[model samples]
Target: MGIDTFKEKCGYEIDEMWLPRVTAITSILNKPNLYRYFADSPNYPAAQRRLDSAAEWGTLTHEVVERMLKGEIVKPDAKIIPSIKAFQKWRENNIMRISDPEKDVERLVVDTKHMFAGTLDVVAEVNGTRGVIDLKTSTGIWEEHYLQTAAYLSAYNKTARLKEKCTTRWILRIDQYEECLGCKAKRRGKEGVLRVTGGKRICNHQWSEKKGVVEFKELEGYKEDIKAFLAAKELWEWYNKKFIRRIPNYAKN
Candidate 1:
């Protein structure tokens, strides 16, 4: 997308200067799994529609999760209650303490040095260690998540006080799925399609009730991850050079 589109879709402008969004930059990376998904789908339009629907669902979950983090009383949409319940269960079992939900939730971070920006989900102290906590509603955590969170952690720490600097990052994935009783297979009905994995194919599977699942993983080697993110940013810049060059406020370097 062009600069105008970034302003509308991503809102990454700082002081009238357009900077590429972290997610937009990361989108430049080749995703083999996504390619396989498209290859396995019926057609391009059908695959894209599923992806779009998944994005909408993710957005809803993000909004609701942010509200819950802020301690706001929320009546979650019926579509996402299972996921929300899973998140709540995780919250109850963990020691993640958001010091100030108002400032910590959905906080926007900018990397002036790198000329990119993104909104981080949460900055909190988990089990006495402070870090960035990114929320996801995907079926599984992928390698690209490391690059995205590394970018957020670097950008956030650049301007944060020493006490507030995040030393690590975590991906908090909340999802709801069913399990096949006979075959021990997991089935997900998100993304506008049903996907089954890890079970005997020929078995007449008795599916379990829909339940939430939460996975929390701490990312390591962020120093290298940030380097990778910058490289991705450079490649993204090259891809959008024509549009980027027209934006007067964007840093030229």
Candidate 2:
């Protein structure tokens, strides 16, 4: 969505007053790659070319599985052909089972009065209990990543009458990468562990495959983050109304 549209929906003043922080905050929630895949139309030809180049796409999946089982960080690479292939496989296996094929299904009604509206990726029964599933592409799983999934759960909870026993939500992580010859040398050195050294810890996290994708469990920090965002949204709405009142009516002249 455009800045103006987002501003109006979230009830925030979009001028120089609150633009920078709002933009940054939104950027965190709206990752560029995620938006491109979900919000934009797929570039079929380009996607096909990448898939063609990764002849050993299955190898990458095996590597991701091995790394998770061994608790090792899968190094990041510019080429993400394997990750795309993995997601394609995941969609073929799980989308229909977890997602309501009927777009008209009454999932939830987000109150856009003080918040922005968004759609849940999957809103169907998971093991006889209703839950949500959000997909992600990453080199490896991490604890902080769970926050995004939790945010989705909070958003869904706000507007939908979720099943009483259905408190479970999940982040489906697909690690897309090609095996590099250099990894052998790096793994032999201390720098290998230092390479994926951001966030709170230096270890690679693992996720268990629930359906077709690696399921990331939600954390308490994510719940607090969502609460803070909703509170800020309310304050932003109030500021916008107050600012509009201060604008002088020059049309009478």
Best by lDDT: 1
lDDT of 1 at 76: 90
| TM-score for each candidate, following the candidate numbering | 0.94, 0.43
Which runs in model 1 stand beyond 4 Å of their true positions?
Answer: 1-3, 6-11
Error of 2 at 117 (Å): 2.1
Clashes of 2: 1
Alpha carbon lDDT at 104, candidate 2:
15
What are the RMSDs of all candidates, in order? 1.6, 13.4
lDDT of predicted model 2: 0.41
lDDT of 1 by residue, 82-150 (tens): 999989989889898998899999999988687788999999999889999999998878989999999
- Each candidate: how many clashes? 0, 1
Model 2 lDDT per residue over 144-243, tens place: 3454345456656675543432365665566422222322211101112112222334334332222233434334455575666665444544555544
Candidate 1 accuracy as TM-score: 0.94
Candidate 2 error regions (>4 Å): 1-25, 28-81, 88-96, 104-109, 112-114, 127-129, 140-148, 162-166, 181-222, 231-253
lDDT of 2 at 99: 42
